[model samples]
Every structure is written in C-alpha cells, then in structure tokens.
Target: MKIGIIGSGMVGRAFSIRLAELGHDVLIGTRNPIITLGREEPDSKGIPAWKFWSLHNPEIKLATFQEVADFGDVIINATAGAISIEALSKIEKDSLKDKVILDLALPLSYSPERSPKLIYSNEDSLGEKIQRAFPESKVVKTLNTMSYKVMLYPSLLPRQHNAFISGDSEEAKLIIAKIMEGFGWESKDIIDLGGIITARTTEMYAPLLFQLSKIKGHYNINISVVSK
Candidate 1:
C-alpha cells in the first residue's frame, strides 16, 4: 500500500517510519520538501525530523503535497489541527476523491491562563469539517487520543488501552482498524464511536489528555474502556 502522510511533524514522521518499516511504501507530504530536508535546528526531539527519518528510515520518500495526493492509495492527515484546513486546501478535492483518510488532527488553542481550548467544540469538529470539505473522501477520525509513540506501539504501556474511530463510512473505519491492528493494537482495543459527528467527543479529549500527561508525568498513557 502506498501511504501518503501530510505534515512532517513528529506524528507524521512516526507514522511514516513505522508504516515503512511494516513494508508499506510511504510518501511524506510537505509544503516544501527542500525546506523540511534542509532544517539544521532540531525539533522537540532534538534532531531534525527529516534528517532522522532519512538516516533511520530511508525507505520513506518525501514529496510535495500534490505528489503525495497522487501517489497514495490511502492518505493520512497528520498535520497540525490548527492549520489542517489550510494545509489540505492546497490539494484539489478531486484528487482526494474516494480515498480513505485517517484524520488525526485536533484543533486546540491555548489561553493566557495556559488551559487548552477546543477551536471546534460541541457545535463542530475538525473531522466533520474535513469530511464536509472533501465530500468524496472517506474521512475517519482516529489516533488523536494518544501520542505518536503510543499510537503505533500500544504494547509499550504493558496494560490494555483503547483507541477511538469515528467516521460515516464503515468500510473506511475497517481499513483504518486493520492498519491499527497491524500496529499491534488488538481488535477490542479499537472502539468505533459512530459517525464523524462523534469526533467532537474525541477531539474535546485533547485538553484532558494534556492534563493527564501533566499529572502522570509522561505522555505515554491511554484510556482503556471496559464494558460487559
């Protein structure tokens, strides 16, 4: 499978490297590949993301966003939530037609008090917006509830944890679920929250996730749902 991932941030890089390692042909989409590859300063991880990926996972290729849209069979939107719309706008909606899109972006805003606020709350959600924007795309909201590390390697936590999926298309969700299972997530670990509207619930969890990280002293935690 050829996977096109938008954004070269940590999430995009992690997904790219892991999927490439899993034998998928991966293409990382960026506004400017040259600029991304030329970065000298390190990111939060203390090394340039492109440089690290090139050295460690050279199988993944870098290309313009348009090229990514053309190359991918399945596209993953891992861009920052705040600029997701702007980033995706560069690609023609027709180019994304009928493709399954795994949307992991969460719209978050920080206040002067330092508390995070949801840009799209109960009335709206980034997932729904994306679906509306690209009516032909099968948009599934997922992987927003956990960090990049925990997303691909849930077993690192030792305890069982859950990930949520919300989208209008059952087939699209199934495709994404298979990918998640390939990443070591059990079938039960994936919970389909029903339709893209429910993305509001998952997207709203961002603030709580940050609070939990502060309380737990690490970002390597996830929610485990138990029901009979």
Candidate 2:
C-alpha cells in the first residue's frame, strides 16, 4: 500500500518508518519541504527537528500536501488537531475521493489555560467533520486516543487494553483495523465505536488522556472496555 501521511511530527514519523518497514511505500506530506527540512529546533513537545529525523530515514520520501494526496492510495491525517482541516484543504477534494483516510487527529483548541478545549460538540467531532468535508472519501478515525508509541505498540500497556475505531464505512474501518493489527493490536482488542459520530466519544477522552499522562508521567497507557 502507498500511504501518504500529513504532518511530520512524531506520529507522522513513527507511522512513516513503521509503514515503510512493513514494505509499504510511504511519503510524508508537509506545507513546505524546504522549511520542514530546514528547521533546526525541536518542536514544542521536544521532539527533534524533522531535518534531523529525515537524514536517518532515507526510505521515506517527502512531498507537498497536494502531491501526497495525489500519490497515496491511503492518506493518513497525522497533522495537529488545530491545523488538520487547514492542512487538508491544500489537497484537491477530487484527489481524496474514494480513498480510505485513516484520521488520527483530535480538534484541540488551546488557550493559555492548562487544559485545552475540544473544538467540536458532542453532536459533532473532527472525524465527522473530515467525513462531511470530503464526503467522497471513506474516513476512519483511529489512533487518536493514544500516543504514537502506544499507538504503534499496544502491548506496551500490558493486559488487554484496547484501540477504538470509528468510521461510517465498514470497509474503511476494516482497512484501518488491519493496519492496527499490524501494529500489534489484537482483533478482539480493537473496539469499533461505530460511525463517525462516535468519534466524539473517543475524541472526548483527550482531556482524560492528557490528565492521565500528566498524572502517570508518561503517555504509555490506554483504556479498556469491559462488558458482559
């Protein structure tokens, strides 16, 4: 599979490297290749510069937002929540048509306050918005509830924790679920929350995730659903 991932952050790099290792063709999409490659400073989260990361990762090529959208058979939205919609706007909607979009973004509205607010209401979510924005594309929201490390490696948590999935198309969800399986998520542990609207439920967990990481001093954690 040829996968184009938007955003060159930790999540994007992790996916690009792992996906390339899985023998898939991978290209990382950014607003500007030169700028993305020229930055020497670490990101706010202290992740190393993309330029530094790219040198060690020659297997994954880089492209503009539009080129990636055109090249990928599957597009992964790994951009920051605040800029996800805007970043995607660079792509022609026609290029996104009928492709499975594995969306791993949360709509976070940051203020000076400690806790950032979720942009969408319970009736709507980033996943639903992406689906509505590009109705022709099949959008599946996954991997947003956890960090890049845990997302690519669920066994890091121990004990059967889960990865939740939400999307309108069963086929698209299956495609994403398969990728999760490749990431070491068991079929039984990958929970389908149903339709894009349920993305609100998963995404709403962001604040808890943030607080939990702060409390635990790590992002290597996850939640499990237990029901009879």
Evaluate all candidate structures by whole-model CA lDDT and list the values in order: 0.89, 0.89
Clashing pairs in 2: none
What local lDDT score does residue 50 receive in model 2, on the 0 to 100 scale?
Answer: 82
lDDT of 1 at 124: 93
lDDT of 2 at 204: 93
Q: Candidate 2, which segments miss by more than 4 Å at Cα?
A: none
| Candidate 1 backbone collisions, by pair | none
Q: What is the lDDT of candidate 1?
A: 0.89
Q: How many clashing pairs in candidate 2?
A: 0
Model 2 TM-score (2 dp):
0.95
Tell me the TM-score of model 1. 0.94
For residues 12-73, could you state the per-residue lDDT of candidate 1 as single tens digits? 88899889888888999999989888877787657466776588677778898989999898
Q: Write the per-residue lDDT of candidate 2 for residues 90-168, one digit (tens) a residue.
A: 8899999999999999899887768778888688888888898899999999888888898887878868888889999
